[model samples]
Target: MGKAAIRIGTAMAALALAATGAPAVAGPQDAGGRAAPKTVAPLMGPRGVDALGHGRTLVTETGGTFSLVVERKHKPARVVPLGNLPTDFPPAISKGPHGTIYLLTGASGPPPEQRPSVLRGAAAPAPATTLFKWKRGWPAPKVVADISAYQKTDPDPWDQEGFPADSNPFGVLALDDGTVLVSDAAGNDLLRVWPKKGRIRTVARLMPRTVPVPAGLPDVPPPMGPLPPAGTPIVSEAVATSVTVGADGYWYVGELRGFPATPGTSQVWRIRPGSTNATCDPAHPRKGACKRYADGFTSITDLAAGPKGIYVLELSKKSWFAFEMGLPGAEEGGLFLVRDRGAMPRVRELAAGRLKNPGGVDVSDHVYVAGPLFGPGALLRLR
Candidate 1:
């Protein structure tokens, strides 16, 4: 059977297995929310026939340093310094085909500007580089992407309005074919760049500045009375905190809503190739787009797609939750696996212990999650 067919079949079987109450092959859970030890096949990297094989994991630290960890030992294999990264650098790293590592670094401190907006592009040289030559360690990555390329092709008001260009880039994914996708939370857009080909494109622009809320949804409290003066812009701050491209070539976006706000919400959006752009009101240039794939989650910080479905990593009041994606009908879709944190104990255990503020996730036969923490970020291996 074809790969897609096999994935579908496996998904159906997993669903049936759940319905039959068949015990999971391995239960990696114990009291106090820790994962119990169980013997399982070690994760392997992709081989000749397998498209999704487990392999070595690499993680980047906040200071632009990287550490490689082998799966079997789960110990640090090597540590290297990434050049051109700033002291305030916040790094996002991903492994391209054949173990080439791509690192994305954000601008250090806030620019000398005051605006309730996220950064869009990097003013300084983006701290991006490729390491690991294939013959020796991994293939050295080529400079195949630039965030500014989109500004040149399709200019948006955010570009002109001083939306922080080098906002935090929290996620990175390398396609098997060398296409690199980076999610800039500050810019609220998914950037696609082909360094090898010197091509740049904005695969999708999100939350155009005209998204509307329900009418009569009191802009202010009764005591406060009238809303802020007319012409006051309503900045959505719909930051794309994390992103992952599926084997089928669809891009999944996770929005971290309301940074620096009390009681923040989160959302998940799926954008397929050739999707249409929603109309933006010329009069209200700062409003966000009306068309959206899905919404309504509380602080979805990371996302991953596997044979089962899209897995969402949610942060609520410093707590974490896992949501499975489901396409309900023609009107976008909704999230499932709600409030069932135990269903994915691996994620739950990570959240409970090491994974604070997780920003990226990728799943194949085994799951790999990355996030920012003290002492060089962590790459958790879930098998």
Candidate 2:
């Protein structure tokens, strides 16, 4: 919900699979991928999407807005606005029971102070970021979660790339029990927020602690040559970008491999339901704990569960932070499909070359995707 859904921060992360069934998982090239051959309309920084039965869909316009697009038989589609964000930045969205809509925004991304260089001529920052909830036909939303108080920090938290530490909540899901799960990419952890309870707590650590890029570069996406001089963290400790509930009743998580643009390093991890302090250990996973659900992907940004399978969207194999750190990457951005649910879930690439920098995804009457996010992106209907 967070990273890919809004991509408010500089990068995105994602991956998901059913824990139910499938044979050997195969890369798109090996699985006879489906070619994407349709364009619906232009979407500005679409970071997330959800579909309500009967042809109605919600697409997030990254910078603080959700376009409620409705299509009918032989009718032109309609788009409506649905957010009151503090700043003009990308945010995340999710649909709950009984026509309920949930919107989440955090106080992160390029702060107003850095706009002179980072944003150049972008909109000014809002006073703060918060979560809003609404039921169908409700003219006003109820402010449920206050992430602003969590934004109060000393000396400011900056990442290895020297960017302001962000509370940019990317992925967000509204559980049936009235609890909300949010992935704070800036915080590199998952948060369990009880809106009604007025409580919040850490759920899991998307990536283990940052590690030094040992000799030979072990798992930093091949052919990157040797490591470069320092300016940022070589290993992406953790950017808990997205989260979803697998059919197995487990919480699946995704993360972005830090700088150096490690292609295969970014992973979608599996976490136990109601699990707290989940340790997503990619190197040496512990049984009954968080481990790699799917690897060999690049910058996975979002995921959506469909009748057929789980849809995965990757922003880019290349790294934005790496490019900033003088370590450019060869990006292969696009959409992918994950089937089965057991440990060895199957995977297939659908349209990567065409769907550049996809931010989020969802399934309904058809599959919907948004890309080139970060700003002025486009939305496509891939059936």
RMSD of candidates 1 onward, in order: 14.1, 8.6
Query: Candidates' lDDT values, in order?
Result: 0.42, 0.58
Error of 2 at 317 (Å): 2.5
- Compared with the true structure, what per-residue lDDT tens digits does model 2 show for residues 1-383? 12222343543321111111211111233223664535455666667777665767787764456668777567666776664444444456788766677776655445555433333222233344566676655544566766545534311232444443456566788888778888776666667778776577767765443434422223334444445544434545556667777666667667755554455566777777787766666667655567667776666667677766666666665543332232333234657788876777798777545655566777777887765554555566765
TM-score for model 1?
0.56
Tell me how candidate 1 scores on lDDT: 0.42
**Per-residue lDDT of model 1, residues 1-383, tens digit only:** 00111121123223222323222112355334567322222211100011134464454443333445444457533333223232223335566676565655443232324222332221233332211111124322234455544444554434323544434445566767887776655566676667566565666555533322222222444643454444344554555666765445667777655322112245555566433343222233234432233444545556767765566654333212111111121111111222222323122223233333333455667666543222223444443
Model 2 reaches what TM-score against the true structure?
A: 0.75
* Backbone clash numbers for all candidates listed: 22, 20
How far does residue 91 in candidate 2 sit from its true spot (Å)? 2.8
Q: Which stretches of candidate 2 lie over 4 Å from their true place?
A: 1-37, 108-129, 137-140, 148-166, 209-233, 322-332, 341-343
